[model samples]
Target chain A: MPDLLPENTPFAIARYTPDELKAALRKMYLIRKFEEGAEESYTRGLIHGTMHLSIGQEASAVGACMALGDADKITSTHRGHGHCVAKGADVSRMFAEFFGKESGYCRGRGGSMHIADVEKGNLGANGIVGGGLPIAVGAALSAKRLGTGAVTVCFFGDGANNEGAFHEALNMAAIWKLPVVFVCENNKYGMSTSTERSTAVRRIATRADAYAMPGVTVDGNDFSAVSEAMDAAVARARAGEGPSLVESMTYRWRGHSKSDRNRYRSKEEIADWMARDPITRMADMLVEHGIATREEIAGLEAGADREIAEAIEFAKTGENPKVAEVTRDVYTEAVQ
Target chain B: MNMDAGTLARPEQETRELSYAEAIREAMDIALAADERVVLMGEDIGVYGGAFQVTGDLVHKYGTDRVIDTPISELGGAGVAVGAAMTGLRPIFEFQFSDFATLAMEQIVNQAAKVRYMLGGAVSVPVVMRMPAGSGTGAAAQHSQSLEAWFAHVPGLKVVQPSTPEDAKGLLLAALEDPDPVLIFEHKLLYKMKGEVPAGHYLTPIGKAAIRRKGTDLTIVATSIMVHKALEAAQTLAGEGIEAEVVDLRTIRPIDRETVLGSVRKTSRLLCVYEGVKTLGIGAEISAMVAESDAFDYLDAPIVRLGGAECPIPYNPDLERAAVPQVPDILQAARALAGERV
Candidate 1:
């Protein structure tokens, strides 16, 4: 269990102790397994509404969240299951939400699209593109105003880069010197349109230059690389140096949503990304770095699979919301 | 309708004559002084004293931290206000013109209104938005609009169009105390109109109608600027031996059904007036409410609705005057309803 890597190794891998490294790898597996279980349940018609899966982007979700704690907050995107699992949410409750159960995160009102754990500082996953940008800036504003010293990370897609909210939110965060990190999970395609076809800049990170903040692009599949970029950005924000943008270059193995026909891209393109599976890469890295043996990695995978299986059972057994209480919670009855 | 109105100031409470704009500013000033959590955000709301001067000198008093001047980004600024409200800060966002609300509808309607419900009441957006609404100053089609109907159509939102200074100050203070998103549409023409306002904190309960004048012949139900016009028409109707009751529907949503129905039952004739477009507007809702209730059986004649012309507010002063329901328009409608003609 001794540290086998040299000092010149990436800061993320080098700085983490053996136990922390294994925990990080475990989360990547849990995120992958959670989405896989959700997809299987969806096919079996257990979930009513549609869901957006983050199958190939587990590393970006887990690595960006490595620096966050209960005090820190994150505003997620439509493809946000991985981010939710990465942020320490109970997968059982998430599956309960997908099953439209009363014990779900939103009491079955918000299905797959809007699960939130405010106690854990997950400000809910947004269904709108670029919807969470300004909200993240607002959360950061609260952090600075209340002197809580908490930072907010905004996870968005490549398509959201073109939204007016993206420009406006980035500008406000920069000018206010608020504690926030803009994490763009660029998966090459916004539905069927590629970044090359839709965006003016080659890299989504380059758009951050216009807002006068530091911007960087990293290999999203590489856990150490993504973690290292997020760590620096989170540190800068916590120190009150204002916000920064980090674009994680990854790809979605599946279509945008359940409705997508997969006619936009080739099977070869999908197979190519599958070959570079982030989970497999992370598992191999742990073995090569001597942090965990092959058998230990297998134990983590099996453990995640077991947890997902139990989560589905918990979701299926949870009670359905009352038909009469459908109109409740439209407005908070409690006076502040 | 939910809480008692804070009208008729107590014997110990003092009053002063202030314009509607000044009343709104006083309410904001009182809220900022009372609560450290309260913050104001808008375009040119700082040293500029706000586009309508409703936030006059507040920036100097509260500084930039509390009286924030956001960039020309309504959507982003509104979203910030919503986020701040959700995370323990009370933000009073100002849209320069009510027309600008269209730009920020996504944040207002989707995020602020639905946040608590979407999150299963885990969060409440205690955000208040002030919009200088209605047309009269010839700002033309773009700047001049009575779009409260749009917000009223959405359930999670509370819409109030305060027609007087007293309601303006009291309703804003009340909105700050409420745990939901509230939109206050202060008519552009009413900003300078002065009235006796209570000196300190008082809440004119949301979802209540005020009886400006009582009569026996017919009921004139109105909103915003039309409330004033309806009162003027009531006076003229009284001289014509027609007793007309004037009901100021201060709150657009949660439409004070009991007050309106009781008035219609007493008077037996209803004239619905508002400044929004004639089709699918506040007037239509009032008319439909009366028709659906027992008040329908009490009616002496068919209900009449007088609203804005089915067109954008024109640039011409004469045409602008003709666009919305003026005093004469209300007078004619009230007289016809009182005449007992079918």
Candidate 2:
């Protein structure tokens, strides 16, 4: 095996082997490629409705989810494509959902923001801010009640920390000692407002102290750092020690939505963040460790590109739901 | 005593009389005993036996794990209940007062109500929220408001107002068995009222209205505590030449439109009485349903609604009586709609 990167700190040892690192690299590449393709689809007037992209925050999504098992559950937010992809959702169905195809995860009813794969243990992505916090708590409660050894990971944005649901959910989980990990992806801005302008606390994880749970803030762009923090949190939950708050400090590369004109932040900020692209960093790490050569990294990118291209094709060719069935699924039962 | 003449046939199965509160408690007891997945979560529900004492002695029987007492955060408890329901736990969440549901509107409306539909029906939320509704005993504005109309307006949620003791038991049991979210609005005044309730597990089918008394001249549709008032008014109206039919709308949504339209067709006149506000109440929905249906042409007079006045439920007994409809208010409204002089 190639020389392992020297351990920089007590918790900084590379957790993943060469093969796992390659898989992690592939997953991140898949998320970025999928989101880029979706943006292209939206610009071309093919995809309808608005979508929140996790374009710059792939490490936070993939790293945290990588620490979870298949039996574990997660509740995601509006900008949840990366979380869903990281949690093992099929890209074809995810893209099909965005395209309003009947073959989509929600059968074309829930668009990008509401994509869910129940079989994959994703409860569902929520449109409302802080909506998934309580849901994750509930899943944890279920695991505890049933004596199931599974844990739950709740993914929300920096804005969700200010929501009442966030406070209530965390407190309940803490009091009950439910097996849940509250993962806050603190992307600098909640829409146009900066985190500093809206939030009263210096770090979002500090709020976890009020709930009496361990709190940690990690470099969200660094997958290894996020993975380490998430592993600790997950272990605490699985061990019945109660919930912990993991605030992944990150930034969003694109505008909040399709209507954004980049008016809130300077191009300098964008350029600066782009230079720290998570995918590039992972590729460099892989090369430095002799996990793969530069050619192998390019091949992985090509593979992800092909996968996204196929997903778009599948979405374009898939059938749209019948207009007659528009009123169906409103309720579990058909009411006259 | 006058309501005895209009009482529906009770089930023959070993039946015993129970107060409305006892009936509801028994329903939860049966549910918890039968299903291991069923849990009761609310404020002061464990040791305090719920704010209304509806969950008395349950915490001791099931232990703290099954009967959970939550913090004062309605939003948090409600969200946790919704989440628990989503993950296969049949949770019965009790709101100390119906008015306090305003604090949990996000979880109830945005989360619980929309989750199934928004997720394309992949999963169902089998959550039951019990709200002690209506006024009496002078709980005042903050505690006395009847907010069933708010929940009935939501699409995915099933809303039921159980006026009788038997219904209080049966409806709650049925709500637990339902595959979706259900809101049970139990009138505070009806808690002490006694009626025959069945012994074992039973179900009062939701979405079906009960015709308490059969009449011809006019129809009085009511809900919650107002159902009792309408029944009393029906007795008084019978003493007069005019006969008033009483229809207890148990389920507000999936609102037995057929039964309502059928009653309207027979009576040729309609008066909706509720404890909620007069404007945009369940009465308005009933009136609209009649006007929009084939019963519109059968109306002998314009529809009238006897609901709470456009004011908060005052703390004073006299003013509180004036704020919401009582037996006298129902009688007066029935007399006017029956084309009788005051």
Candidate 3:
């Protein structure tokens, strides 16, 4: 219950215990394996719609959510499987949702783009760009008004920084002193347009200055850097100080979606980002810190692989939603 | 005090005359007093007393915490209200003008309207949005259009147009009690209209029609401010030996089919009147409903629709009056449907 680290602890892994470090490494593996399995399912024709995979940006998701608890909430982006898993969602239910099954989190209504677990504090994965920004502020407002002492983390892509919603949400959050942290996953590109071509600013974090909030940019591939920044941001929000913006500089190795032709970027760029895989970095860090052996890290990855395999089985065997019950979830009251 | 042998007992319920705006403010006061979860959020709704002065003085009583004054950000404010509603707070969001909803349609249509269904009913967005609509105040095209038809087309949204002070209070209270997102389209011109509204708590059920007048020659179905116009037209028709029935459709989305159909069946004619544009508007849906139902067999004349003109609401008073269907337009349409000279 006391402080996890001493007063001057600067690094995240230095603050975390051996077991905590290992668990974090396992989550990063779980996120990587889940997306890989999803891609495989798509290739096998088991999945119908295209998905936005956060293949190489696992550390940003895991690290940003490292300080949050089950009570804390997160509003995620379209590429949100990492955030969902990082926030303690069951992968089987997630896979069930992706497969459009009744046992899924959204009862087959919401697919990959809208997966949500309210009980787990995953507000939802929004399909629209910058859609979750204002919603996160509202959630924070609810927390403040209800005296719940809960902090909300809003995850958006760099493209969202240009959206009107981003500015409005940030301004409102700052003015009302809402308990929220705006985490921008700067994945270099919004579909095909790179941040250089789309965004007006050199860095998205600097835009937070206009809203009068402290902003920080960190190496999103480095788990310790992201975790340290997020921990401080979340602490500020929970203390009723106000919202802060944390820009996670990362990249997606795969195409934006299944329909992406991969014509916008070169093969060299893809290989470059893949080489700095967040999962591999986290694994190596755990090993170097003496928290786990190489064999131990391999076992953790193997465990994630097994879990993903079982999740696919669960999703494949899940029951399809009935046609007669299609409109059942449209309203809390029965359809007139 | 002993009563005389032939004296009647006094009624327990109390009623008072209140303008449409006052009725709405009273409803908000009641909602805030009855439940701490209720909060009002809008631009200048606090000290400025709202652009239309509907939420006047309540902010003074309830404080800024309850009656919130949001910035001039419709899309973000609407989304925040939806999020708050989903997370246990009852937020009544007021749009400065109904035309401004275009900016916030992404949140209203995609996020608020579809969230519950998309999330498999895991959460309910019980947000109430108040939009001052219709083109009477000379607010021009940007500030004055009646855009309720667009919201009515959305499935998960409940759209209502309260024509009187009574329904304004009752229906607003009812909307707050609803578990789904409800949009109340208050015509700007009707804010000053007064009517006897019941004191204390009451509800005018959504998805029901109010038959303001009964006639046999033809049925004139109207919404929002047009309901008053239809009533005036019906009165003028009576003096001309043409009996026209007036039906006030309070709720547009889940339309009161039975009431409309029953009136049409008796009158054997139909005339749809609304301030929204004629093409692809609320009247189009009503006409289609009557034609597809068994009431089609009872129709003695072809259905007529009196709606706004093709162009935007003009700036000139005359053009503005001509743009939307006025009382004379409704009267002429009704007389024609009744096989009389316009």
Give DockQ for candidates 1 onward, in order: 0.62, 0.78, 0.81
Alpha carbon deviation, residue A245, candidate 1 (Å): 0.6
- TM-score of candidate 1 versus the correct structure, residues matched by position: 0.97
| Candidate 2 lDDT over residue span B222-263, tens digit each | 998888888888888899977888888999987999889999
Candidate 3, residues B138-222: lDDT per residue as tens digits?
A: 8788988989999988889999999888889989999999999999999999999887788988888888888888779998899
lDDT of 3 by residue, A152-261 (tens): 99999998999999999999999999999999999999999999999888999999999999999999998989999999999999999999999999999889999999
> What TM-score do all the candidates reach, one by one?
0.97, 0.97, 0.96
Query: What are the clashing pairs of model 2?
Result: none
lDDT of 1 by residue, A44-142 (tens): 999977999999999999999999999999999899999988999999999999999998888988888898888889999999998999999999988
Q: For candidate 2 chain B, which ten residues in a row score worst on lDDT? A: B1-10
Q: For candidate 3, what is the TM-score?
A: 0.96
* C-alpha lDDT score of every prediction, in listed order: 0.90, 0.89, 0.90
Indicate which candidate wins on DockQ: 3
Which portions of model 2 show Cα errors greater than 4 Å?
Answer: A1-6, A9-13, B2-9, B340-342
Predictions: Cα RMSD each: 2.5, 2.0, 4.0
iRMSD, all candidates: 2.7, 1.0, 0.8
Cα deviation of B126, candidate 3, in Å = 0.5
10 residues in a row with least lDDT, candidate 1 chain A: A1-10
Prediction 1 global C-alpha lDDT? 0.90
